[model samples]
Target: MANPPLTPEDQERYQARLQALIVEHRDLDQVISHLAENPPPDQLLVPRLKKRKLQLRDQIWEVEALLMPDEPA
Candidate 1:
């Protein structure tokens, strides 16, 4: 189902949240890379961190979709 239209204030909030998620996402990428380069990779921690990254990606997409204009038929 499509989300209801967001008010201007809501858009601002979402924009802020989106920026935060993007920053966190980038930071996670760096952390993951650093972890991978170490002598021994983390057998358990990497997967959990990856899962959180995936979740952030999904959230980013959702917020982007919300900001998109409706298609005209």
Candidate 2:
């Protein structure tokens, strides 16, 4: 689906939200990497991180879908 162009205010808001999401995704990815290196882990963090990562991935996909106006569906 082609995305419509955003107004200036909407673009600013979208950029801010996208930046925050990218930071969150990076933080979760780092936690997952750190967990892989350590032994005797809490065991719960992996699933949580994986779940968060999936959620963030979906959000990223949605955002990219919105950003790419001319992309083919």
Candidate 3:
């Protein structure tokens, strides 16, 4: 569904949340990459980091959907 128009406060909060999400997404991605690069790494860390990354990805998608819900079908 289309996101309702953002008030000034809404816009500010959205921007803040988006920034935080971006940072978290990037951090999780980096962790996954590091685990991949290192051999015999923390076996559990990879899956956990990847799972966190996926969660962040979902959040990003949700925010993007809110931002431009009319982009396509």
Give the top-scoring candidate (TM-score). 1
lDDT rank order: 1, 2, 3
Candidate 1 regions off by >4 Å? 39-42
Tens digit per residue, CA lDDT, model 3, 1-73: 5567767887778778888999999987776777688845457878877888889889988776666536454
lDDT score for residue 9 of model 3: 87
Off by over 4 Å in 2: 39-41, 71-73
Superposed Cα deviation of residue 24, candidate 1 (Å): 0.8
lDDT of 2 at 31: 80
lDDT, residue 44, model 2: 83
lDDT of 1 by residue, 8-39 (tens): 99999999999999999999999889888873
The lDDT values for all models are: 0.88, 0.81, 0.77
Q: What C-alpha lDDT does candidate 1 achieve relative to the native structure?
A: 0.88
Q: Where's the lowest-lDDT run of ten residues in candidate 2?
A: 64-73
Indicate the residue-level lDDT of 19 in model 3. Answer: 83
